[model samples]
Target: MLDLVAVLLALGLLMYLAYRGVTLLILAPAMALLAALLTGGLPILGAYTQIFMTNTGAFIVSFFPLFMLGAIFGKLMDDTGSAKSLAGSVSAWLGPERAIVSVVLCCAVLTYGGVSAFVVAFAIIPVAAALFRAADIPKRLMPGALALGAFTFTMSALPGSPAIQNAIPMPFLGTTAFAAPGLGIITGLVMLLLGLAWLNRRAARARAAGEGYGAHADGVPGPDVAMREHAQGEGFDIAELSGDPAPGKPHRDGNLPPVALAVLPVVVVIVTNFAFIRIVIPMLDTAWLAEPLFGATTIESVRGVWAVIVALFFAILLLIAGNWRRLADLRASLDKGADASVLPIFNTASLVGFGAVIAALPVFDLISETVLGVGGGNPLMSVAVSVSVLSAMTGSASGGMSIALDSLGPTFVDLAHATGVSLDAMHRVTAVASGALDALPHNGAVITLLTVCKITHREAYGDIFIVACAIPMLALAVLIVLTNLLGSF
Candidate 1:
């Protein structure tokens, strides 16, 4: 049908243009209107003003706090030298011989602790570059190592992760960040071990072939225009990093806070997050939540966001207090972190708007029916596939997952209840599924990682695809099978 053709064309153009570096702010709305136009009889302007803008605004309202706090938290960590201290300590303790492991572990800790992957990339690259050179490992593999750690397990499968991917499913499933801990641990371990095996084996092959951190023109550490553009599209303002003493390079250990002091904020993030989810929020008198002015939502709908915000708030305070002497201009750092959160939240919101318009199309029902019709009567499989496909289409795990849950969350909830499926298992599946196929060539995160590492897709994407994409897919499959066999833990 012409409707199907129109939707596919719009999606294809969106993906291609996004991959070519067109900002999604323009592409998302433009492509959305294009689809509306092609679908004839649709109210194009109304779609834009009502459907698109409403969803976009709603997304911003619901998620802006998390984005602002997360960006500020990551910025504070960077400005205070905590991120560098942690990365350096990991590299030093693991030593250069374990360059790949050190880089992966460093990224894992930062991202798991709630630092933006962009911040993790910038923070870890110098340490990774130095280690790769020292260990005689090929520099091209650095992106894969970074991708495996920051992009895979910690971002999605790790229970208690403060990453947006992990947070996004909570409201839809009425689950906590620590959803299905047993299953999450198993899936996270699978991604970590399988990814390490692949990366280490590749490194061994390259070593046998006598390749060592090959020379490059832009090998020096610094964010170029391309990196900034890609980073901004993903919601990280690389301009914020320009204020750093060395900008792109890592700081010396002597100047960094002790590893204990540096890592304590991260500890605070996890501990306080757990405490608020299990103790603080539940103990509050949320009975007033039923009031109409409060959107008449329940505590479960808001608990996850509240926990993350409070945790990040305290963690930010701790970072500033511990590093006051080092944070030269405190106001500037806070201002920049606030500024950085804007673009990323809006960028993702635009994608949500685009998805809103597409979902409004009469044709979207057909699409949803087809998606729901699959999974062999299993709501878990249906939710996973839907989230994964949409994530791949939008090139954003959160964006895609948001759209899927926004539109189909209720339907899936009904199906789960009908089938006696646990909401906790659904939560874990949705979060893990988002991380699977969203790392395509067009993904903002993928482009930013390649740009940051100064490597081409041809050179680094194979391994990145395996670790961030392929292995995560494998982990998702494992999660589904285990959940199906044993039910939620």
Candidate 2:
């Protein structure tokens, strides 16, 4: 039908424009209206205000705290030099002889601690570069290593991760951030191990091929004007978030915090998040949550967000307390971090808005029916395919996940119930699915990473594709099978 054709055209244009560097702030709404106009007989203004803005506003309202606090936490880690310190220590301890593993772990530690992936890429690249050069490893593999650690396991598959990917499913599924902890741990390890195997094998082949960290007149590309624009649109302005000494050069360990002190805040994020999710929130007197004033939502619906917010809050305080003297400009760090969350949250919310408008069209009923029918009524498989396709189309894990959940979340939840699929398992599958295909070449994170490393896609993208895209999808498949067998244990 023409409506379906219009929907596809709008999506294609959105993806093309976004990849071409148009800001989603403008692009998302414009795409929504374009689709609305083509649909015919639809009130375009009502689509924008009633459907689009309503969804966008609701997403922001529910998620802004996590975005703000998470950004602030990553900024504090960067400014206090804790991120650099932690990364440096990990690489040093692992040594360049294990160059790939060391770099991967450095990213994993920082990202698992609630630091943004953009911040992690910037922070770890210096240590990784130094290690790669020293170990005679190929520099082209650096992005893959970073992607494996920061982009794959820690960002999604790990239990209790404060990453927005993991948190996005909570309200929809009535599950916590630590949902399906056992399965999460298993999937995380599968991704880490499988990705490492692939990267290490490539390194061995490169070693045979006589390619050493190849010469580059340009050191690590600074977050130049163009890179900064793309990065800012995605989220935190990494150029502003980045500190002195530039990116490629390693920081002096003497100026950095002791490794123990540097790592504590990250540990605090995980521990406190777990504690709140398991203990604190449940014990609260929250019968009032059912009142209409509170949106008539249950405690389960809000507890996951609350847990992550509180964990990040306490972690931020700990970073400040422990690094007080180290913080050169505390106010500036807080402001920049808070400011960083705004664009990213809005960007993703707009994507959700775009999806909302499209869903309001008659064609969406057909689309949703098809999506829900996938896997022959298997909710896990259905969700995996739905989230993955949307993520690939949008080139954003959070944005795509939000759009998928915004449109089909309730339907999936009902499917889970009827099929006796555990919501916790469904939550884990949804999170993993988002991170799977969002790593395509046009992805903002992928582009910013290649730009920062100064490696062209032609040179390094093959390795990145293996580790970030192919390997994570393999891990997701494994997760689906395990969830089916184990049933959310």
Candidate 3:
């Protein structure tokens, strides 16, 4: 039908425009209006103002705290030299021979502790650059190293990860961050090991080709050269690189905070988050949450969100307390973090609005029905494929996951129940799938990583595609097979 054609066209337009570097702020609403107008009976302005804004506003309301707090926490880490100090210690401990693993672990630790991926890239890149240069690793491999750590296991498959990808599925599937604990642990390890192997292999081949960290084609010094220049007070500054001048200059080991002190805040986040989810929130008598004003919510619906928020709050205070004397301007850092959150939240919310409008069209009903019917009654594969395709289309994990679950979550839940599937399995699978295709060339995270590392897609995207996308997809398939055979865990 023409309605279906219009829906397809809108999706195609969204992907194309986004890939061409158009901001989603414009493309989401424009593509949404196109879909609405082509459907032939809706008031275009009403759809934009009413349906679109409502869904967008709802997403922002639900997640603003996490976004804002996480950004602020990451900014504090960057500003205080905590992030760089941790990176430096890890690099020294791992030695130049194990540079790839060192970089990957640094990124994994930060992200698993709830730092935003965008912020992780910015915070870690200079360190990654320095390590790769020291190890004589190809500069092009930096993105892969960073992506492997930040974009893989810790971001999606790890149980108790504070990543938004993991959090988004909690309310929808009525599951917790620790959903499918056995499966998540297994998948996380698989991704970590396999992705590391791939990157190491690539590094070996690049070494065989005698390719060292090449000079930046744009005249920026390679990491080693830059560090040498800094030694002579003529190089790119760390303060400038991180956009915070608190850590005025690189310090000798004696001048830096102790490694344990540098790492304590991250540990606090993970530990506090776990305690809240496993103990604190459950013990509280929150019967009042069932009131109408609270939408008659259950503990399962809000436990994960509450845990992460409290954990972030605790971590923020800890980070500040640990680095108070080193801070440049506390107010400026807070303002910068708060300001930084606006674009990402709005970008995703815009897509949510676009999806809301698309869902209002009659054609979306047909589309949802078709997607829900995939895999011949296996809701696992059905949800996987549906979520993957939509994520690829939206070029955003959070955005695509929000749209798919908002429109089809109930249907997927019903299908899982009918098929005797565990909601935990569904939640885990949906969360992992969202991260898979969502790493396509156009993905916001991928773009940001590439931009931060200053590498072209031609040089770095292949490795990212393999480690972040292809490998995650493979892990998803393996998870599906294992769950189907062993029954949900």
Q: Candidates' TM-scores?
A: 0.96, 0.96, 0.92
Sorted on lDDT, best first, the list reads: 1, 2, 3
Candidate 3 clashing pairs?
A: none
Write down the lDDT of every candidate, Cα atoms only: 0.88, 0.87, 0.81
lDDT, model 1: 0.88
lDDT of 3 at 436: 87
Worst 10-residue lDDT window, candidate 1? 244-253
Where model 3 places Cα greater than 4 Å from the true spot, the runs are 217-255
Better of 1 and 2 by lDDT: 1
Which residue pairs come into collision in candidate 1?
235-344
- Tens digit of lDDT per residue, candidate 1, span 97-118? 9999999999999998999998
Model 3 accuracy (lDDT, Cα) = 0.81
lDDT of 2 by residue, 456-488 (tens): 899899988888889889999999999888789
